[model samples]
Target: MPIQTSANSRLRQSVGSPFLASLVSFLVGVSTLLVATLLIDAHLPDLSLASGQPGWLLTGGFLGVVVLTGNIFLFPRLGSVQTVVLPITGQVLMGLLIDNFGWFDSPESPLSVARIFGALLLILGVLGVIGFLDALVRRTPVVGNSSDAGPQLWLWRIAGIIFGMCSASQTAINGRLGVVLDSAVAAALISFAVGVATLLLIILATRTPWQLKRIDDGPNPWWMWVGGFLGAAFVFGTAFLAPIIGTGLTVMVILLGMMAGSLAIDQFGLLGAYKKRATPIQLLGLALMVAGVAAIRLF
Candidate 1:
């Protein structure tokens, strides 16, 4: 009886171990990412303007794949909602920090009232879209298994928030980096390197199963590269323009571009996920976000 009880205890601990580790990893990953953005900004202040040199943009794309792939593995285990929400929240906070402190390149950038309002509108729009989607999903008969539905539905909502926050942060950080790195490719490479290095350390320390074999399957998917490239371009472009047009204004423009791209990506379900039809509510949300952005720019 004693031996049996001990075995059962071990089994319970083993089951819980991954969950605990994943949570720790997620927090650490986010912290590292925030630090990395600052470091990249400081490390390559002139990366955007490098001329007469071979561009390293492709390398950056490769690194993006590595970073995202790592996320894919880590997210599911770490509660998809948390995986999405916490990062997004972190990004927003970081953006505010960067803007207020002039951490990277925006020394004169101040977090104005208009910018705060814009950010809030943007957050609301995202939440509205997510809520609408959850409603739609619940209405589907095919997805009506209560037991399976409850957790997943909540998870998706959480994921959406996280994704939104992360997107915002990505915009701010990349934009700041863009100021220093002239070529989008170079910025991608440097950021990718940081992401890859961070993940690699995690893998080494935790003995996580990272599959490099996945990269050799075929010519890499264009969409996978798109996120990184677009991200890089946005960052570079934003940085270039942020100084001339305040940080808030720069993000406003980028958000518009992101909305367009994200809509297309979600509508088609291009990455093997179910196609997400954009409803009226989503359009309304987008409009509100855009309007808020525009207002920030004008006021």
Candidate 2:
């Protein structure tokens, strides 16, 4: 996951516009999947399966843009800790909702007292993992400016939460799409295709320039182009896993692994990330999250 994000970071740098960069990466990914599907003689997706309910598939692409754009806008304003942590809170909460209600034809993992406790612990763990708790203790902004003062800042924070909810809901919707299409890969590909179409419309509507000529800077590394493949893999994994594991568990496990990778990235300065050794509090946070997951799973 960190590798995927690092690739996205490099791609963002290579392409001046984040939206354009995402569109290009997703295009490469979907094209690759289409070719691979043909090569494998895999069952091509039945477009008819999507006839009655196109909105489910559209959620994946549309909400993805919301998240990408949300992160781009919120990170600077809310500080990295709040930006990352807040969305995670929303993801887990919304994921729990989906799981409890069995929304999107997903398996139900109804809420329980133990699960609620585990969730609270998980949120706290995330706060600690990102150093938000520590920063709050010191009365300092959490790892960025975070000084965007006003009622509007709260609005952006709420937007951040909504973006998080969008992510969790996207996973559930794509899972249902996968089931309907009878192919997780196909669902992921379709999701990426929709995202591409959506981005194109936004570009046209906003009068955003293509800026393709900027590639003249020089040939970008091959790894930078791998974002699309990584993205495809991620979407496919979530679509495949959500139905089997339940949305809440799926999101929890993903978050656990994501933060773990993030800590490694920070500690080792991997993928051009800033070098920062993991603090004891962060390690403790990871432990608490592990415990939280255990609590959720065991009960």
Cα lDDT tens digits, model 1, 97-213, are 556776444545577887778777765665444444445556732122223356865665455444543444444444444545643334544554555565456557776543222
lDDT of 2 by residue, 1-299 (tens): 77788887778777777887888788887887787656653667778978887566657878887888889899888878778887998999999999999887788999999888888888888888888777777797655556767898889889889889999988998898888888888878788888888888877887766654335577776787788888888888898899888889888888888889989999999877899998888898888899888889899
Q: Positional deviation of 200 in candidate 2, in angstroms?
A: 1.3
lDDT of each: 0.48, 0.83
* Candidate 1 off by > 4 Å: 1-86, 132-187, 208-235, 238-244, 251-256
Whole-structure CA lDDT of model 2 = 0.83
TM-score of 1: 0.53
